[model samples]
Target: MYRLLIADDEQLEREAIKFIIEESFPGSFTICEAANGLEVVEIALAFKPDLLFLDIKMPGINGLQAAAQINRVLPECRIIIVTAFHYFNYAKEALSLGVVDYITKPAPPEAVVETVKRLIVELESASFKERLAAEREQQLQQITGYFEDDLLVLIAYGEIEAKEIEDYFAILNLQAQTFFAAVATILYPNTPGASILEIEKRVLNKNVVGWVKEYMQKVGRQAYIRSIGAEVFILLLAEENLDEYQARLTGMRLFTELKEALWKEQQIALNIGIGGLCNETGQIGQAFSQAKYALRYEAAPDSIISYGDIERDQQQVFYPYHREKRLYQSILQGDIHASQQLLEDLLTWLREHTSCLEAFQQKVYVGAPRQLTLQIIDCAGSKQMVGPAVDAFAAQNPNIKIDYIIGTSPELPSKIKAQQMAGNVETNVVLTGYDAMGSGLVQQIWERIMPEQKKSFPNLEDNYLPAAKAAFDLFDGYGIVFAWCPGGPMFTYNPDRVKNVPRTTDELLAWCKANPGKFMYPRP
Candidate 1:
């Protein structure tokens, strides 16, 4: 339902318009009346009408002045000019004030009814568009959160391409030119008399992490916080042109405040370990390791430890960043011998330098041997266009191979599912339409192929159109449609046969009605 205000100096004119509206659009609007433009402005402010009809000639404020004032207050309200005179200047002024319709006094009832109905249609359309835009924004936010979480996991435990990280930063609008990792551990002593269940402990730790994340955001800090263990949360503090000493101080101050807040709110003791600064995002794993090593030196509760304080030469020969990178590269090249040699060297260095060789060996092993061949299944009809680009990408990256598979929408998902169930996932990526995969197929494929919680694609939105990115929303974060070529509903006509072709659906319908059997379109 909508509200409408009709204003005219002549009482008879107002009644005629009101009667026409009541008879034409019953129950559609609740009507209000005003005798002059001043009364129109006053009633409009109090009533907040959806539609307003105003007469031009008035005693005090004119219709144009009242419209300007009403528009300032309620910009969404639709206005109509109801005047006795059909003056060009009045019509122009009404147009400038964004009046939707101009009806002369003693307007035909049909014209008045049609004008009101048209405005209603426009309002409904605008409302629908707003709803769609809001839903799209919400979906994009969810996808963005997933992307950020995936990137953080890769930076902490796995390796990712530098270009891919840059693309992610672009999509997320993060200015993380430099970063350092920190590990926050909750100190909860298990008493001999009181035992806490494992699940309860996990929940408590999660709450603490959430509280810290909220605090960081409230204080306008550029940080990414993720829970990597039962009671351990990893924070990647990022900034532009980061100063090492200043970053360390900032980390210390942040942890201090968090410790105080947690103690006061939940009586929780927290210890934070700060790592060395890393200029490259790829080296975040190294920073994480340093932070973990620093955490070992936190002697007291609610303590803060920096790796630089304990270790004078922070650049140890056994540092896994460079060695692990090399090992990954070697594995990607299918060089078993070089990868084995590097692993052996790293294990030997760990045994000589660290007392906890087993733990360090596990970390090295997790980081070293993950080289995958991505199988891309393109179900869309753009394979012929994108095939050469795929080949060029493969040529550039000699270490990785891409197997581009072209298949129909019906065949690809089932084939991939079969391969997955058989314990062999030949298809690692899929390029298809939004509805290519059947319901629940994406979840099944994701569980089988990426069980380790790896991302299907890094920064998927940065490489595709927003509409195309939205198509992958149904994938449930399992896959992304990186490329799309829209194909449907093409119209063709010969200029000699048809002049002034219709461009819109309504126009086409009208043309068809006028031409009878002469105009034809495909049923589909």
Candidate 2:
């Protein structure tokens, strides 16, 4: 229901308008009446009416003057001028004041009803649009969160490309050029040879990321936080040129507050390493390295160390951060020989620095896949196949990281297309069936393998079965066949309702023709 206010100097005129409205709309409106301009303005302020009818001539303050005052406060209120004269000047002034319509003294009931109906339609439409906009905003925020997580993963692995960064910047509306990386490590129980998974469970159960985010908000800083195993990577963004002093100050404050908060909430201690300021977009990896380097000196729990505090000879210190990253990537890609060589080199260097290899064993994370990440969206209902395929793949390629989500086939094409149009496409791979494949084909969003790249998998099609090969041919290089299920379309009906089920295409057609509303099918 909406509020309606009728204002006039004459009591008879107000009654007539009210009777007409009540007769037409019935219980649609909560109607109010005002005898003069002052009374109307006061009632408008209190009632916040959706519609108003104002007489042009009133005692002292006129209707136009009252409307101007009301318009300032309740701009959304629809006002109609009720006047004794049909002067063009009054009509012009009413329009200037945002009056929807003007009805002369003793308005026809039809004219009054018509004007009210039109305004009601407009108000309803505007309200619907507002609700729709709010819903879209909520969905956009969720997508932004996903992009943020993806960006942090990319930054942590140091594999972020310029285009990928640009896309994220557009999605996040990041106007900052300067950034610094911070690594917060959980000071878990000093159990001999503790696994990363075990350590993560202990800290993650306490929700350290949530605490860190809360502290960040309290301090009014912009940063992306990602929890990887036992460590949390924070990429702090700055709009202006951040000097080393300012960066260190920010890190100290953030880490100090975070450290205190964690201990207070869950008795979990955090040791943070703050890297130096980096202005370039591509040098975030360097910041991460510096943070990791600083973290090595964290001798005790609740320790906060900055790269600037560490005094080391840059030329003498042997830190193969990039080589170690490459080794991890190699292991993820199932390159045994390259990873073996890299591992030997790292061990040989470790042997020279330390007397016993036993001490270094505790520092290294065994059986942990922390380097590369992939996000997979599946719409084919192939979880039983893809889950084991990914596990088997991970078993051989131990360093590869995968995040999977199941989606509906009908929504995948449009969702992905919308993401692309918004300049933030998050799906790395889409595992979908033929119906969605047809939709994707029309959308033209899929990335096709070029002829040159086909050399890497020379005999790809020859290994497939006949039916699978036919499906692959239909894709036209957009997708590949990983598995096949032998099944035909089946009908679903109540046993008591339909004793004889449709056995063939003709039977289904006949059933559908006979029972139009009862027989329904999903999109092809």
TM-score of every model versus the real structure: 0.42, 0.47
Q: Write the per-residue lDDT of candidate 2 for residues 210-292, one digit (tens) a residue.
A: 77777777778788887864578888877777677887786677678778877887788878888877877766766787887
> Candidate 1: minimum summed lDDT over ten consecutive residues — where?
443-452
Instruction: Write model 1 residue lDDT over 396-479, tens digit each, in one string.
Output: 877677877676664455566545333345776666654445422532444322222347445555776766756656555555
TM-score of 2: 0.47
Cα deviation of 11 in candidate 2 (Å)? Answer: 62
Task: Evaluate residue 142 in candidate 2 and report its C-alpha lDDT on the 0 to 100 scale.
Answer: 63
Kindly report which residue stretches of model 1 are placed more than 4 angstroms away from their true locations once superposed: 1-126, 189-192, 236-240, 313-524
Task: Note the residue pairs that clash in candidate 1.
Answer: none
What alpha-carbon RMSD in Å does predicted model 1 have with respect to the real structure? 19.5
